[model samples]
Target: MINPALQPLSDYTFARLARMLDGIAPAAGKRPILLSVGEPQIQPPAFAAEAIAAGSHLWNKYPPPKGDAAFLGAVTDWLTTRYGLPAGMLDTERHVTSISGTREALYQLGFLAVPERKNGRQPVILMPNPLYHSYRGAAMLGRAEPVYMNATPENGFLPALDEVAPEILERTALCFLCTPTNPQGRVASLDYLKRAIELAREYDFMLAVDECYAEIYRGVPPAGGLQAAAALGGSLKNIVVLHSLSKRSSGPGLRSGFMAGDPELVGRYAEYIMFGSASTPLPIQHAATALWKDEAHVESNRAHYAENWRIATQVLGNKKGYHEAEAGFFVCMPADDAEALTKQIWREQAVKIVPVGLMAREDAEGVNPGDPYVRIALVYDAETTEEGLRRIAPYF
Candidate 1:
């Protein structure tokens, strides 16, 4: 029999988009511009490849599931410098582990944290509306109730933890928060993060902070979860911050990232990885260590996204539903009807974008928070991004 949890899920975002446009052909003679997926088109630095090659001989050796000392050392150093955490505050052996990617770790965290029940009721996994699909999938497959905290303009596009009812918080087993949130690009403030961490500790839930887009900001570097944990006290209790080279170093294909936090939770997660997931290959770990150590490539990568966002503002700034994104690499704009707009853009301009409704679920009141918008990834070179934005500007 099919798992009962599978009954609640619809097709994934991209797969649903493909089905929606199955019969429609792109406009004749116009080259298709795909802005639907968040894949970065920039190439990572040459040194990454060199590091991988240098460690090529280790390909036959099974990588340690918890991670090797050298790679974990690099992560610890990077975290300390990037977040200004005090030296030795992070115990690499207990506070960190190599993840194949944040997506994999995020999904596995559901299994690691969620139990069959909380307070004798079905557990709740809280996440923001218009969330990364992985969060929803994790909660659902783990057999917990997925609670969506709608992040709309009324709340500055950041979900307010204080607004959640006390009953809901008590049953929460895991909570996922995304900084520089996907689609909306809003960053959670330091105070907000601290409050969230405090709530998680008080309610005794695991707080999973997705900071994968932490390095793609335009004006100032966004504050991070680890920073908040340090500011509150020296403890990493009840919080784990996830980082990835995907957006930071423009190396999604490398599939390298790590999660760091509470010693007990992290240790369990590391052990869980030993049985539940594949270890990151030694060569990839070597490349990732190099990528994490160097800020030059990340700076350059941010420049490309900055340029692309600038072009978006210059082209679509005056449009009715357009606003400058605070961070992250998407232009999520409002539309009268997102699905229709998506199809029209493909048919008329040969451009592809995602209807925001497809990425989010309806609330208890039956209103889908993403119904009024569409998400376009500005994850391309400035010129191509401009072309795509210009083509879809009229719809907004």
Candidate 2:
């Protein structure tokens, strides 16, 4: 019943996994170890639970269409500290809006940003090819061309912005880049982000950087879009960065994140969300506000992930393509043949993994960007993850 704008959107990997195994049980009542989805199994912060309970008194009142003032201030303070921004870089009142998570904001960007024409051509949404499908879906639904750029190892796992043809830039309306990227776990450096922001300014498009995985890393905290924006200047002009409590606080159920950038875009996004947006519930918003303000739990969560990474390295060791992720909890390693390997692991080992082909798109360069790869999510509790590895280790 929805319009044609949404008719061609591709199914997400998890949905496909659901369909492929329909009418099937995982090894006679055993829910086969699932290392396919990135949902975190880390225990959520204690303060979040307390905040939610404490804020329950406000449930009778309708939540603000824009988030509560204190909530916005909390986000602003966190940003100021996290990125060391000049006070004006993010105005608590005008430059930030709360979304359930980056995923929803990323999806809604298509509705707000995509246009019929830019410089007299179909608008383009430039993205890393094997990307979060929302970028492409938003492009298609908004009636724009989707420009696929290679973000694989040969390009240092960052899209080659300079290599893009000028013609494409003329019509580009939006560009999405993720730091500590999904599946591959590649972290974009500060220099890379500065170049990207420069390109967005030069080409006249909005740069939407996804920094959800910024908190989980091997060494120091991952370089974020906010840091890039700050380094370029204290002003958040052409860029909006989205960060979440999902990975940082181990609370995906909270479905909360903040988008901070240009005041004009934030104002417009607030309007769009006034009708179409799913705002976080008041108690949940309070919980998120608390989570953002406190970093103690976040540090503990990061340590846990690091420990998990150690366990992962010890189990898988250094096989071909077993590169250490600079950030994030995923390992993108090649399978001899992705689908065949997934099928083999599912049937023979009773373990489920997603084939990379379903996660990426093919381009004119004849690259199935996800080909020969299987994405493993180190998202489970340590014991479950160990069980998953014990079952699928043979493939590696």
Candidate 3:
């Protein structure tokens, strides 16, 4: 029998989307363009394949839960340079461990941080309303109350810290913050991140930052949780920042990334994975190390996304609700009715876009902040992206 705790996670975003468009076929003679999911269409660099091939001889041996020293060192070195942390601020063995992807680590954080009770009450996990689905599922499965903080245009698409009740903060076990947030594409500033860290410390909860999209931005590099900690006197406590090569190197298939911060938390997570999670293969780890060392491919990937944004603006600039995404590949725009519009675009134009309502939780008044918007992923090649935008523009 299934566990009762899983009841709250019945409808995943993509599954719900598929059900919504089930029997309806796309418009006649037009190719279906799927912008519903944020999978990058670009090919990963050739070096990834070469690295994997070179390390393939070790496939017979079981992979290690905590990756090899080379992989760990590569990740730590990259983090130090990326966040501008002090040279010796992070110890390879003490501060970092590799995960298959940030998604796995993000979900595991709930189990890693939640307790039987906090401050004599059920523990709470706070996340933005239009959050990554894994965050909510993680909280429910871990038996923690998932608190939805509404993030809307009024709040610059970031959750407002002041709105959280004092009581919720008191029992909070973990807080999930996504920078270059999914669907919204809003990046959290250094000061904003510092404040969240401060709250987590004050309330004695874990702050898990999902920064998978850290490498895909339009302007200045987004500030990270580790960077904020360095600014706050260089201590890694009550905090864990996750990074992934999925977005950075356009290698989601690689499924390689790491969680770094709070030596205690990282250590516990490594222990948990040792017993419960699958180890990342040795070959994959080798490929990931090569990826972390190279920035040229990443720069090229960013340029492609930048051009996609330019194309979006040129095509839909006059639309009333269109706003250029600050970072990440998705464009979240207001709609008369997100679900209905999503269906209309699918049926009439053969273009698939995600309804933000599917991702957001309802507010106290039962109003979903994302009910009026649709999120479209601009992850295709320039020609494909331009065509998709052209098809979607008419509906707006």
Candidate 4:
């Protein structure tokens, strides 16, 4: 039998988008410009391909279960340089594990972190509303109660940690906090991250900070979870960070990323990977190593996304309830009925955008925090993104 825990969750964001527009065709003669998904349309660096091809000879061999040492070392160095962590704070051997992508790593973590019971009751997994759907899947499959911490306009679209009751914290087995959060691009402050880290430690639960979009920002780079740990007496206990080359290096097809944090937690996660996980292919590891070691392409990606946001602002800055994205490549546009707005945009402009509610579920009060907005991805080239935005601008 299928896992019963999957019953309550809604269809995933993309799948729902497809079903919503299934029988309806876009406006006649207007080619569909898909702004619904967050996949980047830009080409990754040429060097990534070269590196992969160079390692073609190793294609026949399976990747090391722990990780290729060079790949892990490159990731360690990138984490240190990007987050300003002290040298040697993260041992390449004890504190890192290779994965196919953060989505897989984050979901697999549920198996390693969630227990059958906590405090003699079913455990809870806390995730922000308007979440990355994987978190809820992880919680459900792990047989934990999935609690939604709503991030609404009233709180600057960041989950209010202070408001979670002490009882919920007591039973939490895992908590996922996405920086430069998807759908709503809000970055957590250093203090905010530390408070989360502190709570994770106090509650004896794992705090998984999804930093997949961490590298795609303009102005000051967002603070990382490890940076918060560095300030908190240099301890990584109860904190694990999930990062992906998908956003950072525009290499989602490469399917490589890593988890870094508390040695004990990493040790257990690596052990699980040895037998159960799909080891990242050896060729992809070589490509990831090159991507992590280089920053120029990442900077170029930032500039391109910055231009997309700028175009969005130019088109809809003064439109009612439009907030320029704080970071990352998506902007959530407020609407009276986001689902209706999504259909209207597709029918009239032939431009596709996702209703934010589809990515979120109603909380305890029967309110979905994402109900008021539609999420548009600015992942296309600026010119194409601008064209798509102009087509949908009138609706807002």
Candidate 5:
């Protein structure tokens, strides 16, 4: 028998999309263009393949859950350079652990942090309304109350920290904050991250920052949680950051990422994964190590995304409610009826985009903040992206 808590998670975002477009076929003679998913279509660096092949001999070796020394050192060096972290501020062995990807580590964090009760009540897990589904899944399965904090235009598409009630804060066990947030590409400011870290410390809850999109931005690089912690005195207590090679290196298939933060939490997470989760393969870790050490490919990838954004602006800039994203690869725009528009575009132009409403939960007043928006991923090559945008522009 399945746990009753799992019942509400029957339909994931993509599953619902599939069900909605089940019987409807795309326009014939025009090959379908999918802009609904955030998977990058760019080729990862050639070094990735070479590194993997060179390390293939070690594939049979049982992988350690905490990752090997070389991989950890590369990750630490990258983090230090990328975020301008102080030298020796991070003790790799105690502060970092490799996971198959950020998704797995992000989900597992709930189990590591959520307790049976907080402040004599059922523990609460705070997440943005239009959040990654994994956060909700983790909270529910961990027996915590999932509190949806609304992120809407009124709040700059970022959840307002002041709105959360003190009672809820007192009971909160885990809080997930995503910068360059999914669906809406809004980047949180350094001050905002610092405030969040302070809250987690004050309330004595775990702060999990999902920074998977940190490397994909337009102008200034987005501020990271670790940067905030460093500026606030260099202690990583009550905070953890998750990063992935999927968005940064355009290598989603590699399934490599790492979690870094408080030594105590990192130790606990390593123990949990050692016993319960699959360790990242040695071959993949070697490839990821090379990927992290090199930034030329990342720069090339960023340039491609920038060009795609330029194409998007030229194609759809004049449309009502069209706004260029601050960071990340998605173009989120307000629609009169998001679901109807999503289906209409798919049926009429063979252009697929995601309706943001499906990813968000209703607020306490029973309103979904994402009801009026649709999220289109700008993850295709320039030609395909331009074609997709041209097809989608006329409708808006």
Candidate 6:
């Protein structure tokens, strides 16, 4: 067998889920509840179906690698409107490119950023400790040292700029920042983002901001990368923001997203994809364009997630770490030990939740930042989440 490190990291999250539920048959007496994966249970917008159906003829032809003109323009318009970027902030001819979804684009970026060395030393890829798994995989595939910055509670669950020690930034090749961060459901404020962008420019490393969860906030709209770019003199020079229709439109199956950044990098990534990536299928592109043009459906999807969070806080309100999720769908609640609680919940209540450790890794520091907390993705509807919490409160 090949070395395990050569295998994909994503498989670990699910494989652990499988083992946790091993040989455990679901109780026929009660329906099983899943609060593990982030896949949204809400119905996707109707426009997606309509758009894809209208573009049925395009299915017969191979999608052009760079994306169709309409798709590209819809993408640029979205960047402008959502982040309030000035006109021409992103020149589509050089600045924008499409991917099947964020995963591939994000992972591929490691290959684009990491070089053999910086000052004759192995380049580093900076990532928040409890980060999206793809970011780590990107660093490994790029052959750069994956430097983990603890995004634990003390840091507001946000990576700290001042704490990045000057040495790491100097040797850094790329830094991945996921706002409205996964599991934690924390958003990096605008000041935080601007500071990170400034650090990236000073260190001369790429700033990759994963804003896939940008559309699902609770109270205030999120401060996105494009907004940060506008503040940083309206340039997409050191920034790369990745957005997807999956979370934005609850259309993960469509597998559509785009990246806007330094035109040189975007063009390079698109070129790299041309030889390897099956371009976002034209039908999917059409659906995505329609999604970008219409915000009504996104508002509805956002409401569903917001409702689920409200239901979560109502049930688990008094429990430790139960602040209403500010953004994204996951809730991070204090647990004695995530692995133990995960199994206990499945065996006793038949409710499936992922251990926070599965979503994070232990660095040389011997601390998995997300440990002692289980990540509950409120992926179901109001009723289902309420029931899951009702059963969950007992175990915690």
How many residue pairs collide in each prediction? Answer: 0, 1, 0, 0, 0, 0
Candidate 5 residue-wise lDDT, 69-163, digit = tens: 99999999999999999999999999998988888887787788999989899999999989898898889778899999999889998989888
- lDDT digits (tens) for residues 301-396 of candidate 2: 888888878878878876788877889898788877887777777776667778877777788778887887898888887888888876777678
Per-candidate TM-scores read 0.98, 0.95, 0.98, 0.98, 0.99, 0.96
lDDT for each candidate structure: 0.90, 0.82, 0.90, 0.89, 0.91, 0.84
lDDT of 3 by residue, 1-396 (tens): 988777756677887888888988889989999988889999999999999999999899777777889999999999999999998999999899889888888888878889989999999999998988889987976799889999888999899986899999999999999997888889999999999999999999999999999999977999999999999999999999998888899989889999999999989987887789986899999999999999999999999999999999999889998888778999888898888888888889999999999998897789898899999999999999999999999888
lDDT of 6 by residue, 20-49 (tens): 678877655778898888998887878789
Better of 1 and 5 by TM-score: 5
lDDT at position 41, candidate 1: 91
Q: lDDT (0-100) at residue 193 of candidate 6?
A: 91
- Model 5's alpha-carbon lDDT is 0.91
Q: Cα RMSD (Å) per model? A: 1.1, 1.7, 1.0, 1.2, 0.9, 1.6
On the 0 to 100 scale, the lDDT of residue 89 in model 2 is 73
What is the TM-score (0 to 1) of candidate 6?
A: 0.96
Residues forming the 10-long window of minimal summed lDDT in candidate 3 = 3-12
Q: Is candidate 1 or candidate 5 better by lDDT?
A: 5
Candidate with top lDDT is 5
| Location of the lowest summed lDDT over 10 successive residues in candidate 4 | 3-12
- Model 1, 1-396: lDDT tens digits are 877777545657887899989999999999999999999998999999999999999999999987788899999999999889988889999899888889988988788889889999999999999888889888876788999999899998899889999999999999999998988999999999999999999999999999999998888888989899999987899999999898899888998999999888788877887776788899999999888889998889888988898899899999887887888898888888889989999999999999999888899999899999999999888889999889888777
After superposition, the stretches of candidate 4 with alpha carbons farther than 4 Å from their true spots are 8-10
